[model samples]
Target: MRVSVVIAAYNAQGYIAEAIESVLGQTVPPDEVIVIDDGSTDGTRSVLERFAGRIVALTQGNSGQAVAVNQGLALARGELIGFCDADDLWTARKQELQLARLERDGELDAVFGKVQQFVSPDVPEQQRARLTPAVEIMPGELKQCMLIRRDALMRIGAFDETLPATFFIAWLGRAKQGGLKTAHVDDIVVRRRLHPGNGGRLHTEAQNLQTLMALRKAIKAQRPPE
Candidate 1:
């Protein structure tokens, strides 16, 4: 199965190259790598230009991560859709293991694994003190940690653009609602950087409110009928 990896970047000049290189280094290389620039004013565009034909580059106004991801999703043409954050690194066997497990479990719709969050120059010493070895999503929560079937993603419908900070939760909720048969892999799929510039670390009040609203929506949907 061909895997299309989509990366949503916004002013990620410092780490974007590393992220792209990690994907390129994958043992089972992806069929295509699509990068959504998201109107970055920094050297992000210049860096992307250097890659040239190596990646499919698309640029839009500074909307948000949700929009950028959706744009890539809309343009994706692979049988399976994968995602990578602009600042995170992927394991070399992320796709190989993912596809192998997928081939093994023919009934599964998606598979996700844990993240290794290590100390980085971007992370402050104080925050590093409380670092954890692994970051796993809760039983009912959804994260873009694995490869999803392209048809399944399209069936889930568009991501909630209003939920800029937490639209992923909503999108995952949609996948679950669509009866997505998901599995948790034991391997490390991603290396999450805990730098000061991490977008989730800098959630504005507005984005936080959107996140809360999205959570409420998910909770409401999951509730049993009265």
Candidate 2:
């Protein structure tokens, strides 16, 4: 199956290249790669330009990740769709293994793997161990660790733009409600970077609260009819 990877970037010059390289180096590289430059003010655009011929790059005014993701998703022509954050890296076999599972179980609409938290090399060795930790990513909240069918994603529709922290979780919850079969792989497939500019830190407590509200609504909506 043809696989497409979407990357939404914003002021990610320092790490976007690494993110793209990781995708390009995947064991079973994606058939299509879409990068949405979400109004990056730094050198991110220039960095993306370096990969002109290799990827389909799009630029738009500052829109949050939800819109950026939708923009890229709309252009994806592959049978399977995946995601990678501009500041995160993926294991070489991520797409290969996840796609294999999805294909093996024809009923499964999506599959996700584990994630490893890692700090940049600039961090001291002593703190690196504590800072960088490996953990399993639960279903209904995984973005980086997921490989989904394009049709399933279209049925779920675009993400809620209002949410900051829980957009992805809410979307995943709906995917379940939509009757999309899902599974998990007991393997690490994403390297989630812990940096200063992470969305968790950028958004405020009030915004985070909105995420909680969104999740509740999504779960409530998924309930069977009384």
* Cα lDDT tens digits for candidate 2, 45-68: 999999989999999999888889
Counting clashing residue pairs in each candidate, in order, gives: 0, 0
Residue 140 of model 1 has an lDDT of 19
lDDT by residue (tens digit), candidate 1, 115-204: 777656766668766543354333212344778878777778878888878888778876777698988778888887767676666656
Model 1: residues with Cα > 4 Å off, grouped in runs: 122-142, 204-207, 219-226
The TM-score that candidate 2 achieves is: 0.89
**Alpha carbon lDDT of each predicted model:** 0.82, 0.85
RMSD of 1: 2.9
